[model samples]
Target: MMRYIGSKAATLPAIQSIIETHASGATSLCDPFAGICTVARHFKRLGMRVETGDLLWGSYMFQLATIALNEMPTFDRLTPTLELEASNESCAAILSAAQKVLAWLERSPGRPGFVTAGFSDAEGSGRRFFTQENAARIDAVRVQIAKWRDDGLIDMLEEAYLLACLLDAADRVANTAGTYMAHLKSWSRKALKPLQLRAIPIVNNHAQNCCSRTDARETAKTNVDVLYLDPPYNTRDYSFYYHLPETLVLWDGATPTGKSGVPATRRHQISDFCVRRRASSALDELLGQSSAKFVVIHYAADGLIRHDEILDMLNGRGKAQFADLKVRSYNSRVREADIKAHHRIYWCDSH
Candidate 1:
């Protein structure tokens, strides 16, 4: 769930309330946004069938590794030998690659400069969040992981798990705030620390779950008991925020261009799905296609989609009810001061 954007951890109580109110015996849950698969994971733990899907590659990795662990291999089964060894040849190669990339980035124009990047606080040193050496090490690890995948030494599930862990570690050591576009006001000049990676243990089993990469509206055929809609709220696009990590995972050294081309792939553009007019059409399509008894749409007050508009849209179609769940969100990545606000969660039921 740590990797998903717009996690519903804050709205779980409300979500659960809606589920309890509407769900009958043996229910299945669907979260269209499905960032990090948190909602799907929660429902899975409760012995409910869960189906999660997201557009982002990283989001897919999170779901495959954490949420859809039923068919995944155990951590013990993945034994390709990756550990911190001062004399290991693989480690040496990784360190070397990182240094090269760092050197190249130093010449590029960007915030936080290359010399002062990393996740630690040793202020006053000209080092960056990632040392040239550390960057090389990470690059090397990525290479080895890819090799393992190609050789069938590891399955796609294991590869995604390892990649996610690496990304998590890199995120911690990065000098930027939570996002890559912006750096932290206070710079940290400490040497890059080693990243500890762990895989979630899989438990329980159910019928093989199904997933699709198609748009939410297109995927809604026959809804179950509960339908959880958690779309992006504010204009703060997720692709921009997590660009660095994405580059590392999906980096082909394509020479980034425009807002989405270079280091950050502007793949998850908010404009594509954030407009109010589009929301109405999408919602109507979703409701029209869904056969569920209850619909729960999680929205924010600060979003481009208004609560009144959402209620009106839902009200026009069925016997819907709206409940505002006050949620406090703290944005560590926002350029401005940490954002603290109350968001409304709308629960609409159609009998």
Candidate 2:
């Protein structure tokens, strides 16, 4: 999976334990702000019908590829190009297929396009997001994938899987401290390595899982068993900080005008949760509309919504309980050693 700001990969076990303890009989789980589908994936792995949605196009792509998807890609047209044998375990076969596809991509010539022009370390681009060679390789792979999809050579699931691989590959070699706000002045060893696509782990449990891109407030009206919320923690807007990965998901062909290589207008990426003034009100609206029996919210120690306020809102609706967990933060604004942060898990059963 790709690196994300609020990813719950490490602490998913603890949260899942809470959910299992509180909502054991829950049949369905809904994650409206399902960036990269981490929480939804946790529930899906447990054989629950999961509903996931996110405002970010990149996250949407990730959801489609990882959680919402029900089957491993066979790549019929690109056969043996992505070799697979049914006798092998399903996951092993998928990994083999990904290996072959990446091998093919590594042989492709570097082509020029939006990625190469905008993010490459080429002189005068003012962006050092990727090495020039790796940037060109990304453009080549992206262009090839798009061509394949446009020509109907691949189905939606296959396209999504391929794109997901590309996104992860790009993120792997990006010259930053796990963010795109500003590239490091010097390339890290990982950034200097050649870009390589690897198999992205996806869940294919036999559950009726679905994904959507919609407003969280509206989605909260959906009746579900477990409603997991992990909204923006601090002031960092993901749209601005992680815009480069999104460009591949969105495929918008526009050059950035700012020195930081971020677009001038970010209307498409604005979120009330990212604003201090609107955080509480947004939380209120979302909580009021939640139709779930159990609601689990993950918030940072320094988040805009105060501890008392969140507990009050949850308690008003049902039995609210919380636990604190010390997790390492991924704040790019600070030095690597200073990125430590803590999280609070507020679990509620509004019966």
Candidate 3:
């Protein structure tokens, strides 16, 4: 959740009410620009088959944990491979297995590797996103997870769940104001605490779901009953701001370099919707190609793209309506003052 921006969890009630008003009968939903998969999880819980994706690996991990999973994986198939006892209850069994992994991580000594060198002060890196001790723990856990999967000890679903746990734990204790764009000059209270993994509430849904990691524009051709859109509200590139999470998820075996001491990535991946000039055109193009019976888009009223521009784009295709909703978005190190923000909920019947 550290890499989250414009998440729809806060505005779920208002957005869901509007969605039911127009798309109550929809059995299939697609969230093309799914940030943290809050929309997809909502529809999935309602028994709708949902497909969602984002370009970042961190978001995809969220998708794997929240949307891709149809039921809680108990690691029953791998219990022979793993030395943990399984309980009869499905959820309890899964947690036991996860706790087994966490226990190993807790006992293991911290390894000074990618995370320690890149994101922490282990090697005297200027970045202080994590302390030397915490960074080493992260590195040890991440490396062990990778080794477990590579050694055929865990399957894809189990790996994703465990990684999500690790990332979630790290995010809470990270020494940043909110994002990993820049570390705080001094460590915060949370950063000083020892690292620990809490159980991610396993959301078990019955409907079969799928997800992708690609440009939202590319998914417009795929038709669905309801399509949810949550694009970037400004020109701030996520690849640059949340590069640490992306790298952590990737585990590319690449070390940190350069003055910033961050991993290598295409940091210039700013979306067209984030740009002032191209935003209007991009919204029009995405909405224009959508073949859903209904489309729901969440854009900030004070975002780079104006509320009227979003309305015009949606109205061009069919009947459009909006709801004014207030929410608290992430406050960046530079943009800390403007923490409280509002979004215009735009829903349309494209058919």
lDDT at 184, model 2: 84
TM agreement with the true structure for every prediction: 0.75, 0.91, 0.89
lDDT of 1 at 334: 60
Candidate 2 lDDT over residue span 78-115, tens digit each:
75434334335664555555556666776788887677
Q: Candidate 1 vs candidate 3: which has greater lDDT?
A: 3
| Candidate 1: segments with Cα more than 4 A from true spot | 1-5, 24-26, 75-133, 188-192, 203-205, 256-271, 330-338
TM-score leaderboard ranking: 2, 3, 1
* Maximum-lDDT candidate: 2
Task: For model 3, state the Cα shift of residue 11 in Å.
Answer: 0.8
- Residue 338's lDDT in candidate 3: 62
Give the lowest summed-lDDT range of ten residues in model 2: 79-88
Per-candidate local distance difference test: 0.59, 0.81, 0.77
